[model samples]
Target chain A: MHEMALMGDILDIIMKDAESKGIKQFSRIDLIVGELSNAMPDALTMAFEIYKEQNAQLFTKDASLHIQFEEAISECIFCKTVYKPDFKISICPSCHMPSGKLISGETFQVLSYEGE
Target chain B: MEVKLNTNVLTNNNVAADYNRDLFHKTKTLVINVMSSPGAGKTTLLEETIKKLSKQYRIGVIEGDLATEKDADRIRQLGAKAVQINTHGGCHLDARMVVATLPEFDFEEIDILFIENVGNLVCPSGYDLGQNHKVAVLSVPEGNDKIPKYPQMFMRTELVLLNKVDLLPYLDFDVETAKEDLKGINPESTLLPLSAKTQEGMDSWYSWIDEAYQACLKQ
Candidate 1:
């Protein structure tokens, strides 16, 4: 899955940044994953565990991944009704139109990491 | 020590994509990234497209596959320059992969460049290859549930080429329902039904490309 590639990129970013900050080993990683971000959090956790196991030298024995799941929220442009969207393109319940513009739940980023 | 790094996981890919976008804009090349599920007739559509448009414009193609030069060879058979990028097992083509292949084509000599992305409905929708437009091909055989099931692909693409309309009479694919579902997911997207085999309704696709090429020159 692409989650492996996304996890690889996450590790690459942290490793490069951690080196510059004089961090020797990572203890934890915090990621903000949105429901509509195209990345599954469970898959990301599996990938992180695999990377942690393979690159034991860089991570602490108990190094873990913490994902903050963001719910997908959209606001209808026609009615201004806020609701949870099942998909990126959602129909507003109030307006019954496909005018809901996503206001949140598309974020996929590393919020922070603990090391050294 | 806790490092506060608010960074995107796809930052590197986005940076490379921006770089590729700059190059495409500078060269005035109308780049179209065509994506679809496996066996959705992407190559056949490209073959017909090249045949129709090559007389007036110099076209180049970048074919992406898990592991094959077959698509590139097909484009080459049409007498246009084509380069193949095999992802091995990678689900989709990233921006850096496209950057790696940029050296093979002289953009100045190419008026239009079509990037045929790996035939996957899921992974390819997430990555940006710095194309002027992203188009998805959905065949009638894929059924009506595809538009709703793969909203991300339809949401990101500006155009959806509904291929194999020639087979529509034999299948239960509802064109009206497909259009309605697409609208619910992405109202801005337009779906054009056509048969690459029969060459029916291909004129609209060519006109869209002509308009896109004209728009590219203005920018």
Candidate 2:
């Protein structure tokens, strides 16, 4: 859905960051997409592929997008138990209380990019 | 050479959100970000909420839509200053877009700024528009499964306005089950059943807004 907007921003960031570093082309780009960020990796990769094919000046010939998905984590308020949610179910197994606080999982960041 | 740039992809949007938050704090304006699925009676709820609260508070609206300015137009017809941010096929409204529209409103005269986010449950929940409260409108027609199906929306929001409740009798919808489902996902969140069309259960919504406005004044 909104993966296109995210991919657009990712491409912009990469191009600007790479340009400042005097890197003409990137051999690889590494991204860490949090499970709770609501972005689809397949859609992001598809957008990257399309952008790479169209915008030749922005990347090298064999540049690849490496994505690592981080599991969404939440914590129980009552028992203070931290757990990874199964299919976005935020609940404490021990106390059967909802994990009202989300510790992490809405992270959309570029970890690093390899370039010449 | 591999560069070590552990940068947030949404850094720009986050920065914009921070800026908007600061402005709201300075103005002491209570901002509410309203989100829901398409055709979930979000606009209708807002229109009703405005009709009830406008006499007591100076209200301004920021309508986010993909194509037209219809929602903003509706708010303007109610005699409130409204600015529309058309994403032009974009799925959601970011903080940057909200910041760009700030100049359109005279913040000093406005008491409440209600941002009706684009009618999508998933993408809009992820973006923070620097609002004091995030309210999700889940109409009864959307079914009982939406609370569990779209947990993120209910999880992020502090209040869930169960709109279109007048149709509850005709439709096979259970208010109690919806409340239970929301509790499983977001225990801190409160579910308020109301119908904008029939003005049923709208007083609770008005009271919530009044309390939010009072809280904003304290800050």
Measured by TM-score, the strongest candidate is: 1
lDDT per residue as tens, model 2, A37-111: 888899999888988898887778888999999888778788888887654366677777666467788788999
What TM-score fits each model? 0.98, 0.95
Local lDDT at B72 for model 1: 98
- Please provide, for model 1 over A1-116, each residue's C-alpha lDDT reduced to its tens digit, 9 standing for 90 to 100: 78888999999999899889898899999999987788999999999999888999989999999999998888999889998876436689887988998888889899999999
Model no. 2, DockQ: 0.68
User: Candidate 1 regions off by >4 Å?
Assistant: none
Candidate 2 segments exceeding 4 Å error: A77-82, A99-101
Clashing pairs in 2: none
| lDDT, candidate 2, B1-219, per-residue tens | 898788898887888999999999999999999999999998888888889888899999999999888999999999999999999998888999999999999999999999999999899999888999999999988899898888888888999999989898899999998988888777789999999999999999999989998999999
